[model samples]
Target: MKTAIIYMTKHGTTEKIAELLKSKLEPGQTQIFNLKKSKLIELDNYETIIIGGSIHVGSIPKKL
Candidate 1:
């Protein structure tokens, strides 16, 4: 199976988590992106998608 992980991080923590997940699930297929300068590929490119948005101060980033 193939997977794509999309992440938005305010701190390094969320990005680290995304890295871990990618390592276990997709390995070389993992692609890290920041909301400020990130692009989305077609969802059909991968069999699965894992979207991660950081929650800070009780709210999630709207950009995710």
Candidate 2:
């Protein structure tokens, strides 16, 4: 199955966790996207999707 993990990181913590999760999962079509840098992401392409972001003073990043 195709999977995608999209996240925003202010201090790299979220990026690290996304990498760890990707590594622990079984081998498959998995792609990680940094929302702050990604220009376009197609939600329909991935079967499984995960969205995450770091909180800054009780607020998550807007790009997330």
Candidate 3:
């Protein structure tokens, strides 16, 4: 099944996590998108969508 690891990161922690997920789920296909800078506007192709983000000042980011 095709999957997407969509995430937002301020200090790259979220991107790192996404990378880990990508490594584990390779051969399927995975890409990490920064919510603030990414232009991707659709999610129709992903059979499974994994959203992730990092916490700053003990609060979750808006992209989470």
Candidate 4:
């Protein structure tokens, strides 16, 4: 199955978590995207889509 792991990190914590999660999944079947750097993400192509973000104060980033 194809998977997409999309995330946003404030201090790199979320990115590390995403990488860890990807490591447990099938090799070469998972891809990661950083919302702060990646402008365009095509979700339709992925069989499973995972969205992750870091919490700041009381909420996640607005860009998410």
Candidate 5:
């Protein structure tokens, strides 16, 4: 199955976690996107979507 790991990180921690998760999944079947850098992401193409973001205080980032 195709997987998309979309994430937003403040201090790069969330990006690291997303990469780790991708490593555990099937090779070349997973793709990662950073919300801060990516302008347009076609999420409809992915079968499984995993969203991750760094928590600050009590909530996630507004961009997320």
Candidate 6:
């Protein structure tokens, strides 16, 4: 299976979590994208996708 981890982090906590997940998952075609610097990616190519975000001051980022 193919997987993509797309994440946006204000303080990088979410990015770390994404990395940990990637490390624990079974080996396969996997990619990670940081929303802050990545252009629109073809998420359709991935059969499974994970999105990560964080809350700050009781509010989540608009990108999430």
Instruction: Give the per-residue Cα lDDT of candidate 5 at 41.
Output: 90
Candidate 5, superposed: residue stretches over 4 Å from native: none
Could you tell which candidate, 1 or 4, scores higher by TM-score?
A: 4
Per-residue lDDT over 1-64 for candidate 1, one digit per residue giving the tens place of the 0 to 100 score: 6677788887678789988887777456656565656765677877778888877889889888
lDDT of each: 0.75, 0.89, 0.78, 0.95, 0.94, 0.88
Best by lDDT: 4
TM-scores vs. true structure, each candidate: 0.77, 0.91, 0.77, 0.95, 0.95, 0.87
lDDT of 3 by residue, 1-64 (tens): 7787878887887788888888888575766666888776478987789988877789887656
Q: Candidate 1 — which pairs collide?
A: none
Ranking by lDDT: 4, 5, 2, 6, 3, 1
lDDT score at residue 49, model 6, on the 0-100 scale: 96
Total clashes, candidate 1?
0
Q: In model 1, which runs have C-alpha deviations exceeding 4 angstroms?
A: none
Candidate 5 local lDDT, residue 45: 92
Per-residue lDDT of 1-64 in model 6, one digit per residue for the tens?
8899999998878989999989988787788899998989998899999988887889878976
As for TM-score, the candidate ahead, 5 or 6, is: 5
Candidate 3's error at 58, in angstroms?
A: 4.5
Q: Estimate the lDDT of model 4.
A: 0.95
Error of 3 at 26 (Å): 3.4
Residue pairs with backbone overlap in model 3? none
What residue pairs are clashing in model 4? none
Q: Model 6 segments beyond 4 Å from truth? A: none
Candidate with better TM-score, 1 vs 2: 2
